[model samples]
Every structure is written in C-alpha cells, then in structure tokens.
Target: MDTSSTPRSAVVLGAGIAGLAMARVLHDFFDAVVLVEPHPLPADDRPRGGVPQAHHIHGLTARGLDLMEELFPGLDRELEDAGTPRLDHGRDVLTCFPTGNAPRVDTDLGSRLSSRALMEARIRGRVLALPNVEPRTGLRVTGLVTDAARSAVRAVATDDGGTVPGDLVVDTTGRFSRLPRRLADAGFPTPPTRTIDAGVGYASGLFEAPDQSWLALIQPTVCPDRTRGAYIGKLEGSRWMVTLVGACGDHPPADQEGFRAFADRLDNPVVAAFLAEARPVSPLHRYVRTENHRTDYHRMPAWPDRFLVAGDAVCAFNPLYGQGIGVALEQALLLRSLLAARTGRSTPSGPVGVAGVAELTGLAREFQRRLPRTTGYAWRMSTFQDAIWARHRAGRTTRRDRAVTWYLDRLYRAAAADPATAATFARVFQRAAPPTALLGPRVLLRILRGG
Candidate 1:
C-alpha cells in the first residue's frame, strides 16, 4: 500500500445530482476529489443520457432546498433569478386528495420549481468551481480497485485503462447502479435489498402553458380504490411539466394522445383542464421505476473500510413521494457529520497528502451503519403509502406495516380539511418533522372529527 498517495482524497461515482452534491461535501474535507461519470456532462442545462428520468418531473422538497442552500449558500435566490419559480407550498400548491381538496394553510415552506437538468447544472457549476475538485466525465467505471486484503477500496478502475485513486471511495450512482455487483465479484458480501413496488408507471410531457393560479398540482394514487395520480408543476420558461401516474399495473401511456387522455382519468380534473389548454412542447416520456428500494448496506455483516455509498444507491424512494433529493442531501450531511466526528483524535497519515485521511480508516463503515437514521423516515413515508396501493409487493411485510399505513391514510383524509392537521402533515411530508409528529392529540382530534 502506497501511504504517500491521497491520504485525504475521495473518488465519487456518477456525477448526477447525488454525485455532484456528494462531491460538494467531500471537497471540503479532502484535498483531491475526483468525480467519475460514465456519461458526458453537457455544459448547457440539458438532460444527460445518464438520467433517463430527467425527462419527467423531478421534485425537491423545502427541506431539500434548504439543504442545498446550506451547501451552496444563496442557491435559492440564484435558482429564482434564473426564472425558476419559488413556490409557497400553502399558497402555490393544490392537492386533490381522493376524498377532497386540501385546505390551503399558508406557511413559510417553499421550494423552487425547476427541471432536474436545471438543478443539476446549477449545482454542477458550483461544485466544479472548487479548486480541489475534478470532474472526470465520459470515463467508464469498471469496478472498485480494492486493497490487497480486499478490506478497502483504494481507487476506481476505469475501462479507459486508468485508475482514480483516493483514500475514500464513494458511490452515488442512483438506483440502477452496478457497484454492488462489482463489489460482489471482488469478494465483498453483497448487501441485501428491500423493495416495495406499487406496479406504478408514469408518462410525462412538457407544455407551454399560460401563467396559472397555482405553481403545482398533485393528485396522488391512494389505497382501497384510487389508482391514478397526477403532478404538474410550473418550470422555467413558462413550461409546465406534467407527469401522470397509475398504480396496480395501471401504467400511463407514453404516446402524446394517450398521455393527454390519461390525465382525464385522474381524481383531479384540473390536470386535464390544464393539458387541454396548454400547448405541447416536448415528446411524451415514459418511466416505470418507481419502486421504494433500499440496499441494506448498513445491515451488512462485513463492510470494507474507506468506502461508502449514498443517495439513491443506498435508498431510492417512490418518486411520487418526492423524497429522493431530500433524502440524498440528508445522507450527504450525514457523511459530513461522520467525517467531522473523526477529525479529533486523528493525526495526518501521510506528509503532503489529503487532509484528515487518517480518519478515513473506519469512517466508511460507521457512516454506512448510521445511514438508516436519516433514511428510515423517508423510506417508510413512501413505502407505507405504497403498501396501501402497491400491486406488486417486493418482500413480506408484517401486520404492523399495514396498521401504520391505515393510520396514515386517516391522517391524509383529515388533513384534507383541517388546516392544523394539514400543516403538521405538510411538515412531515417536507422532511421538516418526523412521522411520529403527526400522532399528537391535536392531529388525532382532527382525524376523529373528520371521521
């Protein structure tokens, strides 16, 4: 082992939102950070081939936006200045629950309405500006280059006949990542995965719509009866991004006519009305990977040192719940915290090398083990809702799972009309509060009244 090389360095895979955001955190603690991506990242704000779901609506909760602002300060104003609409949830969002419309409860919670492309570009610009960070795009990641003992990954092997070495190797390669397979081949125990799929599919289209009263509209698929959901948000350039979703194998159509026709079947007719008046601007795009799955890396009995996985690579929630970005950013923060925790009682491992590289010895596994603390709330929020609606179940769930989901359904129904209840529900949805926060007596009173 070459102790002189990159004692405080990190190699991050996949430069999408997750990878890019992870790079932002890594650069602050490490000396040299290499961002490896298989696809060519365009300079302009356009969708890259790597993210197929880019064509669909990618949402960020208020908590996620706040996290981004924390990393890249003033990002909120920057996004707004670029024509991204800053939507006040209570005033700008209209949700049509299966039962009725949710009463608008004005609050300070708001987030920018922008395409994934736009958000990625903005974050990329800031991250790439860092002097210690290097963006290596169009490079193929073949596998993890491990130490002689196979106990730690020291670098990333690329098909270009080159390797990017770092003290710590991180994977943020989204849901379809092959890192686990590569690791399994390298003799590490493949972590078990838990999934909850609702047999859901989506068809999305971009339209040039007139200025509307609201910034976003949502009609989610629910249990027992409802199978359709819709979300249409005002993006930059006066373009509205519309995504129609269906559960229980009731997939939405990909064709333009079918896309428009499917909207008419939603619980909320507002989506249909908007579609009828708006002019289509892009080809209809279809996506079906909406399962809530988590690779239980934390629970893995044996984990290598100096290697970590974050973002969707660890846990991908149902996009319908809009938990991906927030959870990803939270995970990055967790990484930062874990790194900071080890800063004390650690000395330099090598001269003229990466800073804090000595602490990297055991931080990777510690970070992985603590990740559930951040992901559990978001994972349950999405999967529990899907339990009521998912047609294709991934694994066996206990009776308590069903019981918890039913209680959530009641809370949603009560939130439809009760402002106080809705506010608390919104807090939980935005990642501002935990799900248990809704179990308060006030929320219970509202639910009983609605019943």
Candidate 2:
C-alpha cells in the first residue's frame, strides 16, 4: 500500500446514478468520498423532480447490465429479488423497427426492465454503504473553487456559502451542469458543444401490464413516412411502463383520450392494443427535451487538473436509443480503468500512490481525449436516425453515402426475414458488437445479392 500516493479525498457532484457510481469508484482510490446532491434522495423508488424522465420507461442495455453486475456483484439477482422483470433481449422483446419486426429467437444478451428511480435507488444504496463514502443532500454546488493559478480545482463551493475540499472533483451533474459557466468565469475557455435536435418528445404513464407472454413490446416509426412510436413494458409491482413518442412537430398529447389515440397511431398497434385493455395507474407524464448534445471537453486547449466530467454532462443521446444509463456506466468503467493504471494498484492489494494535481493532469487530459471514442458509435447511430427525420422535415434530400446507407437498408430488410441476420443486427443495436460487424464478408455478400 502506497499511502503517500493516495489522495486525501474525492468529491462528486450530483447524487444520481452517475454520481453514486463515481463515489463508489473513488472509494477505491481516495481516503474519503463525498457525494453532493441538490435534493434529498428518497429511500424508495419514487419519482423525483431532478429526473423528470424517471416517470418514463427505462431499461439497461445488455452492456449496461453487464457493467452493473461487474461493479456491484449480484446486481441482477438483487433486482430480480426486488421483483424487477428480467428480459432476454432476443426472446422477450417484440421489436418493430422501421426496417421490420426482429425475428424471435434465443439470445445470450441480458437486460433488466424497471423504473429509473428504482435502479438509481439500488445503486445509491450500494454506494452509501461504503464506509468511506458520505452522501450530502439538499446542497447545491454553486461553483468549483480553484487555486491561485486556476490550473486545478481544489474544492466545491456550495450555495450555502460553504466549501468541501477534495483532491479530485468529478462532475456528474447531468446535462444542465454549470461547470462550463464556472470555468468561463474563472477566465478559462469553455468546451465547445454540439447539438442535434430532432424536435422529439415523449408522453409516458404507468399501467397494469397486459396479459401477454412477451415481457415488452416496441413499435418504432420509420423516418419521413411516420414520426410516432410506442413502447409498453413490464416493471416491478406488476405494473407496466408505457411511453408514446413523437418527433419533428408531432408531439404526443398528455390527456387520456389523446394519449391512447396517439399510441393507437404508431407504426403497429401493439402498444395501442396493450393500452386498450390496461388500467392506468398514473397520469400521462410528458417530456419534450429529447436532443443529442455533447460537450467537447476533450478538445479543450487547456483544462484544469483534477476536474473531470462524465455521464450526461459529457454526452447526452436521444432518449429513444436507451443509451443514457448505458453510456454513463461505460464512462464510469473507463474512469475506473484510467485511475487503476495511474495508481499502479492493479489488483486492489491496497491504496495506490496519492495522485497530486500534477499526476492527475495528464490522466484527465488523456481521459477527455479518449472519451469521445467511447461515445462516438452510439452518437452516430442515434443522431443518424434523428438526422433522417430532420432532413425529411426540412424538405431536404438526405446526404448520400451510397455504400453505407444502401447496405444498411438491405441488411435491415434481410434481418426482418432471416433469423440469423436479425440476431447479428440485434448485437449491433445492443452494442454487443461494433458497427463494422455488418461489413464482414458473409454479411456483405448477403446484402450485395439482395438476400
């Protein structure tokens, strides 16, 4: 154990899933970990103002579930014991993508269906149990305090005129993070931002799960032709989470009849059929701010040492893709790996060297530089679809990438009719494989011959 190399403390902003995960990761490297939240966290899986989308349907992708299980062993068992519905990606979900319905078959990919609030609560519970972790509630982070040179963050300034000092600060404050503003105020250049707004929105509600063999149903709309979609899935407490989505000026209605009518108008009537017979347990909750945004902190000419941003603060994708939590989990995993390498504590024998600002500066820069690579694929997939609708709505022709687009259309059609193709594409959609897998010789041959 190299106590001299270990940092005294680490501070994390935002007590959501990302924040909690950050705290847990920091616990392995720092002597003390403090998690600050603006609101008091509930002990149970109840809706909170901080996360409006919590009312909507949410699930962990296969990769996300795997990461959670790695970070918190027995996580799947814990959720199952709590009555959460487990979904075998290929067997349990009936998906109707714009291409076609994915064939039903056996798959090794795993997913869990539950409310975001519940997942957050479970993860937070594990983080709070760590002896070195402290959860501070009802305190807003007003700004980050820097040293005289403003080269590194030394502490977090709270709204109550107080400060929490730490050797490292990780900002998981989500899409509305103010770290950029703080940096600008401190005479530092803010990271450049990129956004692709499809003008999409969602209206969600909780209802009793329909009597069906499948655990979930999805009917997504095709671009240019249709702009509405629906999803109905089982959640804990024997209830179902239903979300109706509309894009590019086709917003869903919040009223009972309108919501039902909207669902009925999806590409398929699966969601509408379930809503027809299901009993509503909650009001229609609407969320309109669905946009893909990214802060390019990695490209900044100069970033303060010991300050890092992850989760939604770094990249927020279109919620329709179900990649937010998954991306956040991957980001946390990346951070852990980065920290492990710098500390030389490869098997957790004991605490590694205390990382001073000088030691962490290079790591921070490297992390930001490499962070985009991790999110690039998901961003491309989600934004590509959104851009299709965006161009269609604007009466502009889609930019032609003849080889790629033509090949994908062919592949999608093949997947609808071929079980093997469906499973292969499913892996890409679930992020189990890289997009290049579709370019393999055999798959390309099938598409070339119009299989």
| RMSD in order of candidates | 3.1, 2.7
| Residue 107 lDDT (model 1) | 72
Off by over 4 Å in 2: 1-7, 98-100, 349-361, 401-409, 441-451
lDDT of 1 by residue, 187-243 (tens): 988789888888888888899988788889888777546778888899988899988
* Pairs with steric clashes in candidate 2: 5-353, 5-354, 6-353, 6-354
In candidate 2, clashing pairs total 4
lDDT of 2 at 234: 92
Off by over 4 Å in 1: 1-7, 344-353, 391-410
Task: Judge candidate 2 at residue 49 and give its lDDT.
Answer: 55
